[model samples]
Target: MTTPGWWAMALCEAVNDKTPLAVAFAGEELVLFRNAEGQAFALEDRCPHRRVPLALGRVVAAGLQCGYHGWTFDGASGRCTQIPNLRTNEPVPPRYAARAFPVSEGNGFVHVWLGEGVPDIDLPTDDYRPVGQQFTGSTIVNMSHEQYLAAMLDGPECLLNFAHVRMTDFFLGDVRKEHGRLVLERGAVWTTQILPSNFVVDYPLIVRTEVPVQGGSIRVDLLSEDETPLISLAIASGANRRGTTSLCWRGFVHAEVPAKAPLRWRTARVWHKAPFTVNSLIDGSAVAALLEAPSRDLHAARPPRLIPVSAVV
Candidate 1:
C-alpha cells in the first residue's frame, strides 16, 4: 500500500544516546538511532542475517550491530560493514543492506517520509503548542484505517445521531443537536465550528490537517480554538488484531470531564459512500482531494475552490 503525505512518526526525543528506538508506522517497523556524531538515522528494524531485530542490539561506533552475530551495518547507508564470524578472506554480499528511510526533525517531532521516490515537501515545522492542559494516550478501535478516518471526519454530526447521542452527551455535555459549518482551504487544511445549545461563548473551532497513510489509514494534526493542539492522532487498521489509534492531547479544555477516555463508535454507521448531508461534503471532498493526487506533491496541486455550506440539523 502507498502512503500519501508526510507522517510525524515519533517525538524528536524518542531517539537518544542510550539505545536505538523501534517504532511501527504505516505497517513498517523501523529503528531510529543516533550515530556517534549525534545525527539521527532510520533503518528497517530487521537484520538481513538471521532476521534478528537490530533495535535489540547496541549502537556501536560503526553502526547498529545485530545481537545474534555481531554484524555491523552503516547507519546512514544501511550497508553491512562487518561480520564477526566471517572467514578472513570471505567477502560480504552486496545485497546485505537494510532498507533506510528519510528522516527529518523539527517542531519537537521526528517526521518520516514513507512514500516512494523523492519527498516533494519539506518536513512540516508548523507550531502546534497547546494553549491549556495537555494529556496523551493511545487506544485500540475495532475498525479499518479508512473506517477510522471516516469516523473522525464525520465530526459532531455523527455525535448528534440518535444512535450516538447517549455516548456523545457523555463526552460533550449535552451539545445541541446542530450542524457546524466546514471550510476547506488551501494546503489540504480545513476547519469546523461547532456551536452547542448550552454554551453561549464556548463554540469550539476544530482545525485539522489530512495526512493520508498506507492501507487507507490517516495521521492527522488537530487543533481546537486558535492553534491549540488538541490531538495528534495516528489512525491505522489492524495495527493489532484490533485496529489501533494513538493520540496525544494538548490544550484540551473540557471542564466537565476531568479525564478523557477512549471513545468508540460503530464503524458501520460512520462508513458511507454518500454524504449524509450537505455539511458532510467536507468529508467526501477531503477524501477526493487526497485521491486526486496521491503523490508527495500535494501542496503544489491546484487549490480547490469550495463554497462553504451550512447544514441545519
Candidate 2:
C-alpha cells in the first residue's frame, strides 16, 4: 500500500554539493547528488555490478563514478555510461541501470515520490523559509506513519481535552489558564491552525506536513506562521522492551535531561484502534471530511476558509 504525498528526503542545502549523500526512505536506500548543471538526482544507492554503494563513489562528468571499478552511471537516467574494464566495442546490457526516483526541490526541501507510475498530485510549494533556525530539532520515534498522522490531526483537540490536559501537564504547559479560540483552515495545499492566544510565547500559525516513509514510518515537517521551518522529524517503528513510547526533544527549551527518565509519560503511544476523546473526535472528523474532497477543487480557491471549533471549551 502506497501513501499519497510528496515525502521530503533532505534539506536543499544539504545536497548542494557534488558528493553523493545516502538517505533511507520507506526501507529503501537512495543516494542524492547534484550534477554538473546543479540539478539534484536520487538513485538507488547500490551499483548493479558489484553491489557496492554508489554513494561510496564520486560524481564524475558522466555521472556517479563507482570507486570500486570506475563504473559510471548517468545521474538522470541511472544508466551505466562507462565501464573502465569493458572493451572498446563491448556493448553494455540494457539491464545495467540503477533505479532512479523523481526528485523536485521546493520550499527548501528535496521531495521524492514513492508511489507507482507518474505523480498525480503536485509538489508542495509553500514558499516556506529554509530549515536550520529557531527551535530546530529532530528524533526518531517508535510509531507508524499512519499513527503519527492521526495523532497530529487530532493533536490540538487532544491537547484541549479537559481530562487528558489535566492528566498530562508535562506535555501541554498549563491548561488552567484561559485560552483563545483555535482556528482551523483546510485548503488546496495545506491544513493549518492558529495556536491558542493564551501563553507566555505562542507559535501563532502552525503548518505541519506528515510525509509517509517507505517502512511505514513518517517524516514530519513543522513550520511557523510566516512559513519558517521549525522542526524536521522522522518517526519509525522499532522494538521497545518495556513496551512503552519515547520522545527525545532537543532545543533551547528542553536541553537539560536525566539519564534514565521514564519514557511512557514523555511519549504518547499511538495505537491503530485507539479511542479518541470527545474533542479529538470532532477535530479528526472535520479533518477527514476535508481530506476526502477533490484535490483540484481545493487548489482552485484563492485562500482557505477558516473554520472555528465552536463546541471546544
Candidate 3:
C-alpha cells in the first residue's frame, strides 16, 4: 500500500545529527538521520548484511555506521562507503547500498518522497504557514490508515477538538474538490452560547477541513461566521505497524479572536496555551455512530497514484 508522494514522516526537530530516527510510512520502514553538514536523509532501515536495522547504528563523520559489522553508508546516496577489516587494496563494492529516498524539510516536518522518481508536485506542507507560537504533537492511533482517513471526514469531532468551540451537524455546503483536495465545511458555535428552543438563525463559527486527494496530509481551520481565520492546523498521517496510523500535527491560534468568545478562550490565548488538540485516544463508539457523509465522495473521487515519466528516466 505504497502511496506515491511526499509523506511527512517525523517532526524536523525529532531528526538530528546525533541519532537516527526510525519511522514507518505506507508500510515502508525507514531510518532518518542528518549528515555532518546537517542535511537530512532517509534509507531503508535494514542493513544489507545480517539484515540488522540501520536505525540501531550510530551517526559518524563519514555517514551512518552499521551497529553490527561497522559498515558505513553515505547519507545522500546510501552507498556503503567503508567496510571494517578491508585491505587497502580491496575496494568497497559499488553494488553494496541501502535503498534511499529523497528528503525535504519545511513547516516543522521532515517529508520523505515515496515515489519512483523525482517529486512532480509541491510538498504536502507547502501551504502550511504558522503565524504565532505553534503547538505540536505526535502519536500513533489504534486504527488503520484508511479507516483513520474515513473517520476524519465522517467525524472529525471524534478525532480532535477546538477549545471553547462546539462543532455542529449543519453542513455549509456539499464536498467539493479544491486544489487536489476534498474540502468540507460545517457550522459551529461558541460553547457558551445557549441554543434557543426554536431553530437558530445562523451559526457564529465555522469548521473547515481539507484533506488531500492522494496523501494523508490534512488541514483544518476554525473560522468566524464571516470566514475570518481563527485557528489553523496541519495534520500528517500515515500507516504504521499492526494496522495503526502515525500522526503528527502543528497548529496555532490566530491573533484575532471572536468578540463572542468565552472568558476561558480569552485567557487561554493570553497564556499562550494551545487552542486545539489532536486526540491521542479515539472513541470507538463515536466513530461507529458517525454516518459516512463527505467521505463517500472522497473515496469515490480519489484517483490512483500515477508514476511520472521522469521516474523511468
Candidate 4:
C-alpha cells in the first residue's frame, strides 16, 4: 500500500490529567501525556519487560511510573531509568526501552507519526482555527473513520444522503472550508449553503452552526429551495474549556464518484429509526473498514487506516 502523508492518517488529543491516554488513530496502544511544563510525549503503551499498558500508570517526578511493578521511564525516552528497589540511581536499563513516537503540537492538540520517522508537519493552520462552532452538545458515536470524514465535506449529496438534508426542502452550502474556492473543475460556478442552525466548531470557541459555502469566488448562504433561509436545524455543542480539542479539516475533489458504500440514501434517515448527530457506520467503505470483517472470529488490536480521498485529490 502507498503510505499516505501525516495528516492523512493521524489524530491528536491532550493528556487531560490522564496519562497513558488511549489513542486509536494508530493501530496500537500509545501512552500520551504532558509533562510539568505542559510538553506532550507519546510512547508505545506497552512496558518493555512485561508489556503492561503504561497508560494505567501515573506521571510523577517528570517520568511515568509503571502501574504493575512500579518501573519508571523517562518522559523524553522510553528507557527504564529508575528502579525504586535498587539503591543506586542508574541510567535506564540497557535493553529495557519501549518504542517512542515523535509528536507535533499545535492548535491545543498533539499529532503523532505512525508510519516512520517524521511525516509532514505542513498541515492546515486555518483548518484547526476555531470557528467557535456550537452544536446540541457533546456525544461520540461509533462511526468508522471514513464516515466521520465523508459526513464532513462530501458536498451537496451528503446533506440528503447521510445527514438527512433534503435538497428540495433545504439547500446546502459551500462545499469547501477555508482559502480554496469550492468550484467545479473548470465548469459553471454554482455555490450552495444549508439552512441548519448556525453551529461552528472553531478552536477555543463554540458558536451556533451555520453552514458556510463558497463557489467560484462567490459566497452563497445555503438555504432551502423554497427560498426561505433554513437555519433552524442548528444546535450548539460544549466549548473546549481545556483548549485542547484536536480539530481536523479535509478537502476531497474526485474526478470519479465517491468510494463504494453499502447503502446509498435517496431521502435520508428513512432507513434509521431516529436522527443521530454523530456519523454512523452503516455498511460502507466508511467506518466498516475499521470493523475488519474477515477477522470476525477474532478481536482487532489497533485502529484501521482510512483511505483519504482528499489525499488522492
Candidate 5:
C-alpha cells in the first residue's frame, strides 16, 4: 500500500557499496544497495526463489548476492546475474528477475519512486539548501504516520522543540497551498519573555511548517518577527512497522541570528550545536489535547490517486 510518489527512503550515506540497507514503507520491505561503481538501487527485499530477504545478502562485484544461496542480482535491473550451481551453458531465466525500482539521490537523501511509470514530480528536497553545519538524526516513534502528520499541523510543539523558545497556539494565517505543499504559520516567543494575558497584536518569533500533499517530506523554519529565517529543517517521514512512524531529519541554524535571541541560543550557534530537538518520546496527553483545525483543510486539499497494482510487484 505504498503511496504513489517519490518518497525519501534514506540518507545517501546510509546506502553504500558494501552493505544492503533495509527500509519499509506502508508495510512493504525494500532493500537498498549500491553497485561497485557507487550507483544506488532499490529492490523488493524478497528473493523470488526462496523468499529470503535480499538485505540479508552481501554486495559483490556484479551486484547484491543472496546470503542463503549464491544467487546474484544486477543492481541496475534486478536481473539474476549468477547462479552458483547452474550448468555451464545454461542461461539465467529472464522471468527470474527480482523487482527493481527507480532510485535517485540528492540533498543528502535517497529517494525511491513508488508509483507507476516515470515520476513527473521534483524531488521533495529540491528547495532545501543548507548554508552551514547541519544537524541530523533518525528515529522511529510510537505513533502512526497519519497521526504524526495531523499532529504536525495541529501541534508541532509536542513533536519537536526549539531551545529557549515557546510555541503558542496562535496561528498567523489559515492553511494554504503553496508550491505543492500545505503551509501554515504560527506565533512563537522566547522562553524568557512572559506572555501577556491580554490580546497581543504581534509576536517576537514565527514558526512556519510546510507539509506535502502527497509525500511525507516536511519543512519547518524558525524565524524572526519579520520572517527572517533563523533555523531551517527538512524531515523525511513515513510508516515503519506496526503503528509506528519513521523519521529522519537534517537542519541548520541560519547565519542571520535574531538580535533578540537569548544568550543560550547565541552560544549554541557559536559552538555549532543543534538549536532544536525532534522528540522521540512524544507526550500522549498533549497530543490528545490538540484542537484539530488546519489539518481538516490539509485532508481536503490532497488529490486522491489509485496506486497501480503492478508497481508493487
Candidate 6:
C-alpha cells in the first residue's frame, strides 16, 4: 500500500503561525492552516483561475484570497468570489473555483487523507508520544497510514531477507569483528538484526536512549520489532538527508514489565548515528530463550550488566 517515496508526517515550517491557520501541500499532504480557529480547510494547492499557489496567500474573511489578481476563494467550496476587474453587479464567473479538500488537525499538526474518493477515516488523538518535544507536522498520504503502521509490525527482515528484498545490484557481506556480526545489502536496503532483550521493559518509558560511538547502532524499542516499526514512532529529521528531505525516525512504546522495587535503566543509543546499518534482531516469542539471555530482559534485580534495549526488543 506504500504509494511511493516516504512522506508520512508534517512539513518542517508549516506550523509557524499559531493563530492564523497556514496552508501547505505536496501531492500527499494537502492540509489547511491550524490557528486559533482550530479550523483546517483541505484544498488543492492550484488556483482554478490562474493556478497560483493559494498557499502563498493568506486567510481572509472566512476564506482565502489569491494575490495574483486579487481573486478571493472560499475554503470549503473552492469558489472565486471577487475578481477586482469585474463589477460587483456581475455574478460570480464560472470555472473560477479551486478544489477544496477535507483536512483535520490535532496533536499540533494537520493531516490530509488523500484518495480519489472520501471514506470514513477518523484521526485518533490520544496516547501518542511527541517527537522530541512537539508534533512536527502533518500529512495525508496517497496510501494507507495503516500501512505505515504495518511496516513497523513486519520488522526490517522483509528488506533483509534474501527471499524478499532485492534491487538492480546488491551485496550481502559477513564480517567477523571481536564479537558476532553479519551484514547484508542490496541497493539502498542495508540491515543488521541483533538478538537480545534490551527492548523489553519493566516500567513505563519514553523510549530510553543512547548513541554509542562505535561501528554499530543500537535502539531500544518499546513496541514490536518487526514492521521495522522505527517508522511510525521514531523522530524523523535527518534520515534521508541525502534525498530531497531528511527524516529522523523515533518510535515509542510503554508497558509494565516485572522490575525490582526500582529497576536500574541503561540505554543503547550509541549506535544511533553510526556508519552502515544497525538494529537488533529479536524473536521475543522464545520467552525461555530470552529469559536466559539477560536479566535486563526482566525488570526485577536479576543481572548486573544488560545488553542494549534495541537488541532485546
**Candidate 3, run of 10 with poorest lDDT:** 304-313
Off by over 4 Å in 3: 1-3, 196-199, 303-313
The list of candidate 6 runs beyond 4 A from truth reads 1-31, 34-36, 106-108, 124-313
Evaluated against the true structure, the overall lDDT of model 4 is 0.38
lDDT of each: 0.46, 0.45, 0.84, 0.38, 0.84, 0.33
Q: What lDDT is reached at residue 56 by model 1?
A: 92
Output the TM-score of candidate 5: 0.93
**In model 1, where is the ten-residue run with the lowest total lDDT?**
304-313
Task: Give the per-residue lDDT digits (tens) of candidate 1, residues 6-81.
Answer: 4555566667756988766545677888887778877778998888888998899988988888998887778888
**Full candidate order by lDDT, most accurate first:** 3, 5, 1, 2, 4, 6
Residue 200 in candidate 4, Cα distance off native in Å: 24
- Residue 70, model 5, lDDT: 77
How many residue pairs clash in model 5? 0
lDDT string, candidate 3, 89-200, tens digits: 8999888988778888989999888867566558888878998899999999988787788777777898999998888767788988887788899988888777741256
Q: What lDDT is reached at residue 177 by model 5?
A: 89
True-structure RMSD, every candidate: 13.6, 14.9, 2.6, 14.1, 2.2, 16.7
lDDT string, candidate 2, 117-215, tens digits: 565355543323333332222233344333333443334233112111221111222111111111122111111222333431533334342322121
- In model 3, pairs of residues that clash are none
Residue 267 CA error for candidate 5 (Å)?
Answer: 0.4
